[model samples]
Target: MSIFHGLSAFPLTPADAAGRVDTGALSRLVQRLVEARVGSVGLLGSTGTYAYLSRTERRRAVEAAAECTGGRTPLVVGVGALRTDAAQLLARDAEAAGADGLLLAPVSYTPLTEDEVFAHVAAVAGATGLPLCLYNNPATTHFTMTDALVARLAALPRVAAVKNPAPPSDEAARHAALRALVPADFAIGYSGDWRAGAALLAGGQAWYSVIGGLLPEPSLALTHAALAGETAQVAALEARFAPLWALFQEWSSLRVTHAAARILGLCDTALPLPIQPLPPSLHPRIEAALDALA
Candidate 1:
């Protein structure tokens, strides 16, 4: 089984004012996730600001996460880049660094045909022996994997799962189509918005969770309830997170999530340049929403 089969939190990499990684804070963040009993930690994914960091910074961030996690939970490193070689190199580095798996998205802004997407994933799979989870954030990558492509890729030995953002309105059809593409052993992880509990109850087995970054307890609770066939409890927990979910939809998700982390005492909310802090005007309302969850 892939190490990334259950609830996974995509943590934001904490950096200092000088742009250096705050390893101490990063360690604490990882420890908190471990304490929450998250199944995996997806390092340097979108929530981790992978695109904002230098390659060296990314490596150091992964290493720090691994060190802090200390084998308590699996660490799945993000390995998507505009260049295939770069993505492969990151995958290799992640493997060498002892990451349990890789979460890959297509090269940024350059939309590939379904065949090319498969080739990209195939190349990464070939480059590193690590298990792979395809990340399909169409909002960012502008590339959506067709059900036919997912079916073909599912047969590959290393392609273990796909992390798709929940599509609008017709989630049931989307879930059914994706489940039909992959075998019973393979999983479809939900990443976008607050549909994770519903998706999980509907047969989605994994989640690349941004909300979990701030509220690990509730997030894990929702996942556990869904897994245990407690759909009503899951719905109750999802209701508590509804306001934060609404905020995520209104603003830059990355910024708001990081800010929520800081408010929750999880991290410092320092992002690299070009990715500024959440607006001061929104802090009171955001904090109030998070406090309500508490």
Candidate 2:
């Protein structure tokens, strides 16, 4: 089975003043990713504000990403929803919209049994012929998939990879356990913090990245360096990115990232309501961080 590899961007879903999806900005973002030579672009994931977007908005974002990407690289659309039926619908819509694969996360409303999670994955996998990448982000969602659960789900024919956002230490162990459970064909992707390059060096096949959406060139370069076993280059890049990572450790990490993107002229800092912009007081600090890295 063909598995996705290399740097995959978790792009932000650009929205208008009324909070509607902005295809024009989204198209520009996708074009930037292609220019930067990222391996793939992921739409409607956490960085894309998937939870804040409506079903219609999600579909539009996926279609726009596919249209903009124009097969320059693979596209993965996040198909996570609070309801299983809705997730399946989104998965089908994503496939119709030309997504190469779907990143599915467990339901968030209630904690699901292992059997329920298995059934959900099976249902989405069965709903569309597209490859599936399981998204495990326990920080936002209440439930976390156990190693055994991942092993069981890895047996499904449609399941191709796992996008793990657990902390670095846990991610290492999870990768080891999951690798033991599944065949070598099944890929393990990394997310969370500045540990992605390290994880990739540790045998992760892909890096699912939020930072890539903001600074695709640097992120892709770092990924290439890590994959090439150039530790010096990787360390140098990580050192430059340390300031940004420090900001992410703050309470308003997403807001800071979004705001920093706008400052860099990448996209607007406009986020969906309930996720207000970062405090004005921190603008200088964010600008300095961006400038140092730039």
Candidate 3:
């Protein structure tokens, strides 16, 4: 099976207040996810502060996670950078560090053309032998991979999958459309944890998850139920995590999730400067969500 399948934990980089990657804490977090049996471990993803970290920091983060994973869990490192060259360099570095796959987002200060996006991914694919998963996150990348573009990208060698946010509607039809356009081996996974169950039920192969990063046991149970088409179990698990999901809807999920992780002592909440921690006013609600889920 592709490393793209099932629950892939998207962890926050456990950075300290000094803006340094704490490899020890990061390894421990990876250990927790491994213990929960997540299908893969993703580092330097959106939740991992990829855009916020410097090149050196990003490289270190990948190396640290790769070292900790040590091939126990498949390591999918995010190599999304504004410049194609930078992204390619990260891709090469990730491959050197023993990453199982690469997740590339078309990040740009200005809008990008379809041809440009295609070339960027192709270039990265050429840079490394590892499989690549295109990240379609318009909210962060400002570049939405349309169905036409996705079909074109998926045809490229070494482009194995896409980590897309859930579709607006007719998700079943959307999944069917992609399936028709791409090869059977190509994987389609959704990242919006709120809609993951529905997307999986619609035929998406995986849930590239933030919630699973800090709390994988419950998330994996939820994914298993979704995959088995056990509607009642899926609904119950989604409902159980609904409070935390609501908080994610209100504020940035990165802040809320990091706060919750901190409360649970899963990792520190020291996000890189300017991102800010979850406000104190929201503490009780976070506490309540954690308590409810606990």
Model 2 over residues 1-294: C-alpha lDDT tens digits? 243688888778889756689888888888899888888897888888888888888888888899888887899999998888999999999999999999998957767888999999999999999999999888776778887888889899889888876346755565676788887888887887578877877778888888888778888888899878888999998998888888887844567778887877778748988788887788888888787677
Using lDDT as the measure, which candidate wins? 3
Would you give me the overall lDDT of model 2? 0.83
Per-prediction TM-score to the true structure, in the order listed:
0.94, 0.95, 0.97
Badly placed stretches (over 4 Å) of model 3 are none
What are the per-model numbers of colliding residue pairs?
0, 0, 0
lDDT of 1 by residue, 1-294 (tens): 467677888888898766677777777888888889898998888888787777777788888888877788998999889888889999998888878889998856655788888888889988988889888887778898777888898899889888888665676787898787788888788887577777777767787798776567888888889767798998798888888888888886788888887777778747887778887789898998787688
Q: lDDT by residue for model 3 over 152-260, one digit each (tens)?
A: 9999999999998987678899899888999899999999888898898889889999988988988899889988888899999999889988999889788998998
Each model's lDDT = 0.82, 0.83, 0.89
Colliding pairs, model 2: none
Q: What local lDDT does model 3 show for residue 263?
A: 84
Best-to-worst order by TM-score is: 3, 2, 1
Minimum summed lDDT over a 10-residue window in model 3 is located at 260-269
- Report the backbone clash tally of model 1: 0
Using TM-score, give the best candidate's number.
Answer: 3
